[model samples]
Target chain A: MRLYFEKRKTASKKTLVIVPAVSLVISLILTGFLLLAFGVSPLQTFAAMFRGAFGSSRNFAETLVKAVPLMLTGLGVSIAFRLRFWNIGAEGQLVLGGVAATWTALFASPYIPSFLLLPAVLLSGALAGAAWAGVPALLKTRLQVDETLTTLMLNYVAILIAEGLFYGAWRDPGGMGFPGTARFPQAAWLPRLYGRVHYGLIFALILAVVLWFFIYRTKWGFELHMIGKNRTAAHYLGVNIKRTILISILISGAFSGLAGATEVAGLARRLQEGLIQGYGYTAIIVAWMAQLNPFASLLAAVLMAALLVGGDQVQMMMRLPAAVGLVMQGMILFPLLAGSLFSEYRLRVSQPHKEETS
Target chain B: MILLVQSVIAITIRAGTSLVYATIGEIYTERSGILNLGLEGMMLMGAVTAFAVAFHTGSLVLSLLIAMGMGMVLSAVHAFLCITMRANQVVSGLSITLFGTGMASFLGQRLGPAENNFYLVGLTAARFRRIAVPFLSDIPILGALFYQDILTYGMYILIPLAWFYMFKTKHGLNLRSVGESPQTADAMGISVTKIRYLYTILGGMFVSLGGAHLSLSYTPGWTENITGGRGWIVIALVIFSMWNPARAIYGALLFGGINAIQFRLQIAGAAIPAPVLNMFPYLATIAVLVLVTWWESKGKKRLGAPAALAVSYMREDK
Candidate 1:
């Protein structure tokens, strides 16, 4: 009996690995097809993409800068998804946070010292994201509205709100009448480690480690996993499922908020329409394809970020629109879904029972 | 006062018309226990297909037919994923939305922008000419109702039809049984997969017409995101209306009324940001969802959704 149980466990582990492995192989083939369709040599194209993104120190720095927000958004998505909340509005949450941080930088820049202002901006951004997400979480928990619909729909509202602010109230006066906030004061800026890229990378890496620890080594983490696996079971065990879910969404939203804060502080340094580079949306695929593991999420974020960076290079070089990256991103999802088919059932040969009777 | 009343009548119908069409379609899909969250994406596809076809062929009828066909094809993809592969309903629905939106945007970009004519543009969506009933069209307060398009009259016809089909017909009973309890329905020798698939496709066709109304009738020309978040709003309205078709119409009209007022209010120089006003439909949906949940949760018998809703079934194992 003990041996049988061990075999069962080993078989399931094999199944999990095999599914993802097959998915990766399929993804490579699809990528090749896409290359061929574009009339480019697949091997040469891939080499150029890699060389463009990581062959030089400057290229490597750009990749890291792109990956930073993706990691934050991935971690945020991981947290919410771990509790089975499916917060699809992280894009909106990220923007809301950026808006909040930008508002702070505009009003509070001269009032505080550099050290204090930076932290204030980041915190204010995170709080704003959490507050925005908290509304949907509360409604879903208290009123049973489907969070998926509410979150997704709210994205438009969030985008429009940001646009309204930029175009109407926050339009910069010093420069040509472009609809953008004033360039953030140098005091509001994050300390840079390299050209453009800054200390935001440190925050992303730290958060990844913290999340890994929390998810794998803590009691609350176990409760969250239980809730995700089976809410009824968690309820029976006297867990406050609603509060846990709400907390999960709030934490996730805050992390994404930090991503937006980082973008403003480290890069753009002002509130502009479309400040976020769709990192929040990409993080959904990152979180899911990584199976929601924090360490794995980091790895997945880098891979996706590489694709985006490379996509830009290929686009500029080939005069292809940036949408080719979307096709590849979508290709990954198709294979990922197909890969899950093996998890639930297996093929078996059945013999006729009538043979014995005959 | 005369202009206010006239504007109110026109705006209310305009706002609600798309919702009325989309919700009726959704009611059909959800009643069969499949949540087609791809409604927005499908509607967008419909709008674009209608416009592209109309532009190319200069035939309004052909454009609408093509749009409805596109809706079916997209819904078929959703049905296959959720029904055949037994994938997560939410994920499959979301994937369809992503794929559909990407495809539509790509196509729309390729098609380039075109002129939108409000009057002569949509034969499929052209406003039905008012037939002034001798007394009804002249009545002071009720006169406004007589000036509606053919689609409005079609909605009025559909409510009773939906009621008759769901409660009075044998097929409706079987379909509802599948939704309420697919296992029981299966045991009773019903084809659960077939019914779900059929209704999903049919429902999708209805939604595409709603999309047609947007391009061909609503604004009388093409607009990107013409459906806006109306698709999601319809999903919210289903719950708000307690899953009843007649009540769904009223709920849609209420949403339409609010939408109309927001636009009119903006034009009237309201101090609120236009973006804030645009948030009206979404805010209202959330509020309605909360109120419905609270009211229903208060009952000893939870107003549970159809038992088989969003679940995948496999017959081979059974």
Candidate 2:
């Protein structure tokens, strides 16, 4: 009996380990096919990409830098998804948050001290993101508007708003009429780690840990999970569904906002029209691939960040377009989804219904 | 004031060009119990294919046909995942959008940034000129309505045909029945799977028309992110119209009007911030969504979506 139990345990462990490992191997092979299509040697291209993304300390710093926004946005998506609320407008929220950060930095320049101004700017960014998210939340709660459609539509509106601000009112005066805000003050900048990577990575890590605790340990988190699992049952159990959804969305939105604020403060140090590079959208894939778990999302974010860093190398070394990364990223999600499908249902072949009946 | 009215008419016609096709396409898919979130991606594929083929061959007619074929193939991918494999429709659709957009953008970048000339070899720009009846063209304000491109007229005719086909035909009823409850349709001798596949493929063809409308009829050139968020707007418009084709036309026009006014407001130098003005269409959609839901939710007579609408069908024996 002892030997049988040990064998059973080993078999289960093998099953658990092999599934994801197999998926990774398949995705890599598919990515190799993509490289071949682009007329580059798959092994050499990937080797160069690995080297370019992690060969030197500079590349490593850049990889961490890229991971900051991705991790925050992934956390945002995973949080919302945990509550069964599909928040697909993280991109728009990031844009609005970036705009808010820029506005705060610009307007608060003379009055606030450097130390005080930075936190305030970041706070404003979070507020703006939440408020931007509040529109769809209100519509969904009050009027029963579909959050999915509203959030998706609002992204374009947010893009236009950001464009309008940079092109019209926020154009820098002394910077040759460029369509961007003035450089942020030194006080507005985020503190860097080792003077290379910004403190955004630290913030994202801390936030991830906090989110992990809240999701797996806290009472409110339990309530959110209950509602997510079943809205009607949670309602009967005395949980306020609308309030939970609002709070869930607000928290998610704030994370995305902080991501944008970090980008402004840590990387750009100013608002540009193209500040966000679709990190919000890409986070959707990361969150889903991680099955909406916060800790899992952290690892997923790192993997995605590595891909982005590698994509740049693919462009520079292999003369491949950067969008090749996008294709690979996109293709990975398909098989990732297919893998998850097996977790839910087991496939079985059967004869035709007539023959079965006979 | 005249220019404003004219711009309203012009923009309404222009905006309706894409929305008309998308709304109808979504109507077909939703009626068959599949919420194709990949409509945006299909439209992008349509736009790219239309532009690429039209640029190379310089044949507008063949370009539209190719666009339809491209959309059919892309939509087939969604159908394969959703119907055959029974995957999550939303996830599959999202994946298609990501894949389509990435692929299109990658190809567009390779093709370079300059606009490819897509004019017919023999026909000039006048070949697409508006046609107006003598009596109707003389009518005030309504006169502007009488003049339209050939595609606009196609949409005008298509709206009624769609409504008739959806409500009056046997296949339409079967599709709707499947949408309402695929199990019920399965019990009633209708092939739910076959209906879904047919309608999904047909829906894709219609959405490709929207994409072709952008490249061939409306925008007249290839640009990155060309369809913008119009596809999403059409999705919202579908719900706002309660999946009715006739209502979708007016919704499309209303959205187009808002779009035109925003551009005009920018040009006229309205005192309101352009950002705020540019926000009008989306804000208007939010308002419309709220109002429609409120209107539908009143008197305990709910006008909810079809119950089985986004759910995958599992043919499990009891």
Candidate 3:
């Protein structure tokens, strides 16, 4: 007997949803085994995680707070991925955004009027992210450098640049020599929506709807998808491949930058080493899980945020290390990737000799 | 100043060994049509596993073996995802790194240093000690290179052997063909899937060996993120060397020298801020990548990249 995969003529929508659900269940089972290996009860640990993320209103709010950056970054990554542009440097771009926001809040805000302060800071952050993303995009278009490698290399450079500033000129003088910038003034702080959640939630939600309109509703969005599916085909259809790619990457970087900027303005209120907590990277997974849909990315981001917040609970309550969340997140992607195969193809069993004879 | 130069050179060779191992490993994997971005995670896993095993069993050989085995196992997951399932290689590789790093960190928390500065306990006995070669150790300026650990010496042999195997052997040609044009290789009766899986796993073992070398010889202690972007540097080095194993040695030395100088400057109380000094290697890597990429494009060189690189093969795909 032999088994092989046959391509489906048309994918079933039911399978599309069910496969990922199956993958998630399998991943959870695998993670349960890992928890067992660590001498923890998977059931109680999961319950604790659920409670930590959503049991209380405040906990749910914290989960949303975490989801804010993930959503923004996820949207950013989805934009680039749609163009077949691998922008792995979202982390660095996000950090650079934070740096730009810090510059605005620290220097420009004190000089500008109160009304202009927030917009200037946010705009600077997004522009900074776009600028950082421009390097790899230019290289890809002009020199044919692989953006995956170049973007990743730039991530370290961005982090180092942030570290350099924080440890040097940006170090708070009055705060006992800590390696972080001075706090943002009241005008610069993003107004909280209750608990720790901030206005970034609104920004992310509005952007998601706008992006959904842009990607699925607009002609330019169709061109982006066309290029992603096939560059030659897109060119034949009059899509300016190079210009579209460059613009898409810039927009992608802007979204990631906004994520970083909002993170600092809304939560941290200061640029520091921890400003980038892998939210940008997590956004990659979230974007993939969302199938690059803007609104789906919002849902995916919330789910990922729950995992992250719940991981922390497992660490505190179950005495497991905080790295457990990372492990779970990583494990989830594999099965998800594997399960996606079922969407495009189905398995068939046959006897080789009998087929040939027939 | 001469003594300082000699010591720095010595440290460069020692530090460069792990990078050389990793670069060669990646070269091997990429040559077989897959790019494993999980080098960092795999290395971290190897480092932590070696440290844990050595801490418990106190057997250097066993620890090294287990580390390599662990790396192979991780890469096998990558192979299954990339080859069998036809998953996006970049996402799969990143996922592997994330999973490996997370698992390593989780395990490290359990087996790592009980307190700061106390990580070296029981590790020193299993650590690779420098062995001086007769008459070779007496050579001036280069004498320190002749006296090094077993892993460094093994690398000296492995580099040349890898080059020979990749260039001069029949299997090497088959592997290259698979990477360059998997469909053609498949039509010509070569098993593209088999070659890919074999080389990726083999490449993973070498990468893990480099990680074990870090824990067992160079640093002799496990720390969170012990590889510290070295895996990414190796990725850059593979490009800088234009996928040539022989050329990778120079790339490794250049990076290793920068790392050594950073430490020396800090120790010497250089006036430069420590953070700026620390950025030297990463900045240099970016510079090297850009320069090499530009040079390759300008010269109209073949770029030496396997044509089918990163493309998953399916037998029935049009």
lDDT of 2 by residue, A6-104 (tens): 112122333333545566677679878866775568888778778767778888777788778888889997888877777889898888889898888
How does residue A221 of candidate 1 score in lDDT? Answer: 92
Off by over 4 Å in 3: B111-125, B272-299
* DockQ of every predicted complex: 0.28, 0.44, 0.61
Docking class of 2: acceptable
Runs in model 1 with CA error above 4 Å? A1-11, A14-67, A139-146, A153-157, A173-175, A191-199, A232-243, A276-279, A302-321, A349-358, B111-153, B219-226, B300-304, B314-318
TM-score of chain B of each: 0.86, 0.88, 0.91
Arranged by DockQ with the best first, the candidates are 3, 2, 1
Candidate 3: residue A91 lDDT (0-100): 94
Maximum-TM-score candidate? 3
At residue A62, give the lDDT of candidate 2: 77
Give candidate 1's whole-model lDDT: 0.75
TM, every model? 0.83, 0.87, 0.95
Q: Write down the lDDT of every candidate, Cα atoms only.
A: 0.75, 0.76, 0.87
Candidate number achieving the greatest lDDT relative to the actual structure: 3
Error of 2 at A81 (Å): 1.0
Model 1 chain B: weakest 10-residue lDDT segment is: B116-125
* Residue pairs with clashing backbones, model 2: none
Which candidate number maximizes DockQ?
Answer: 3
